[model samples]
Target: MRQMRERLGTPRAAGVAGVLFALLMAAAIILVRLALPGGADGTEITVDAGQRGAVQTALELLPFAGISFLWFMGALREQAGAGEDRFVSTVFLGSGLVFVAMLFGCGAAAGTVLDDGQPPSAFGRHYAYTLLTTYGLRMAAVFVFTASTIGRRLGVWPRPLILLGYAVGLVLLVVGADMPWSELVFPGWALIVSLHILKGHRPTDHPSPTTP
Candidate 1:
């Protein structure tokens, strides 16, 4: 059992957590997007049975997603070892917590609308949307930026993956609220990073020696 526990405590465990988090979060986002109408005019919206069901399903999945995300964060920190920079690590951890909090907040707000069996008041709906698309995604952007930076510095990630992270972060930071389905970038990047980590290919740590 001890050996099993030790084995599960490796960076590969973090990669697994990252993969789970990515899938759960992507599902939640897709369900929510399908359930809710687009455009900022919340007052004009109405909720049907299908939409309610979708939102409920999304809310149910969110808590699990958040928990997995926390595990992923811890695993990532463990993988960073003692060489992690304090400032960037702080940003990474802080943004991840804030993102999860905002995600829960959005879920709670949507739950309230469901409980009432009607569309939320325009203010309420807009508030929830803003929390998710604006605050939550911005925090996610920060998390991605910091994670990518740490990965690059540690030589844990390929240059192409790091570049893709930058692009995803920019989208979340600048236009996440304006763009439909932009939140998908977060999970997409997470999936790629997790897969790479799982492959156990840290270039800096395992450089090929020159054949003299």
Candidate 2:
């Protein structure tokens, strides 16, 4: 465990994970608070079934951001160790973990909101929509970042799904102008993270790292 901790980083994987988790938790808390019954005038209120689904959908999308974070972290881990597979493996592993974490969080939030009734309200639905859209932007950033990272590392390139994701992100930004254009910042982020990933490890005389 100690050895694994050392590999995580100077501050360590646990610390990094904690920070990421905290951010997610904070988002969750905000969602939960909003989901609670409240009126437009700040009085207690209730919502309908459709409103409940809308609220749940928005809140659930957020944890997906964690997926990208985890992926980068995993990449960091491999890059941390000394071996042939090194940085590339680290990136893929980290990236995969990020996605997995996102899936879990999304699932949990959805389940909680649906199964457990916490009297719905106009305030909660509105708040959830705001946060959900915010999360969509973050998820956009993650997908763009990951697609670029993988492309740069392996030169294998992004599949159609990735390109589709980028397009969707852009559309969301334009349509949801009220929200920040964090997704629009993806190209820049992709360029930066790609440089860092490339900087760390050079290609061997052989081929690049495979996904499997």
Candidate 3:
């Protein structure tokens, strides 16, 4: 922890990671929404418009997986540092990547299910919907918890953004009430963090007493 405090005393990388992760998170959400049923797929427009609500709900719920994965990368970078250890860090990175990838895959799969030009079996459609929504929410929780804990230990703490993120995530989980929006809040939080990353942190030449 002391080592990281000394390394991150400048705060540049933390800000940079925050901004970059936020952009990527936003992009992931946009991409998933574009590919979903009510999105570019036009399934909802041509067929049952009521299903558009479901599709929109699914779209909102789905992208958190990718956002979570990208945020995890920032957290991982903070831990591993800009050193030779990055190769080792990647091994740990795979889990989050896979989670996000699966969400994307599920989005594509959902689009196909909706576009089949017929009413799907209640069982199969429900199953796919469940899978898509479940993973997104799970991964979002993982990212927030991971960020709050890991960021603190790394001495960067993500400042105001992370605390607000945790609160928003908690409210979404409670008020969302099994709806997929419970997961959507995290992507916006991830987006904020990513933007902070791009802006880069302002560096201070001298370290504080706590920085070892």
Lowest summed lDDT across 10 adjacent residues in model 1 is found at 203-212
Per-residue C-alpha lDDT of model 1 across residues 44-107, encoded as one tens digit per residue: 5677778878889999999999998998888887766655789999999999999999999988
What does the lDDT read for residue 197 in candidate 3?
Answer: 47
Which candidate, 2 or 3, has the higher TM-score? 3
Ranking by TM-score: 1, 3, 2
Q: Model 3 over residues 1-212: C-alpha lDDT tens digits?
A: 45644555434554554455455545545544443433321334343544545555555554653564564465546543543234344433544565567567666655543654665444444444455456645545554555555445444445676677577656544544265334457657765665654454423243443555
User: What TM-score does prediction 3 earn?
Assistant: 0.56
Top model number, lDDT: 1
**Candidate 3, residue 97: lDDT:** 64
**Full-model lDDT for every candidate:** 0.82, 0.43, 0.51
What lDDT does candidate 1 reach at residue 59? 90
User: How does candidate 3 score on lDDT?
Assistant: 0.51
Weakest lDDT window of 10 consecutive positions for candidate 2:
202-211
- When 1 and 3 are scored with TM-score, the better candidate is 1
lDDT of 3 at 107: 61
Off by over 4 Å in 2: 1-119, 158-162, 176-212
Error of 3 at 141 (Å): 0.9
Name the candidate that leads on TM-score: 1
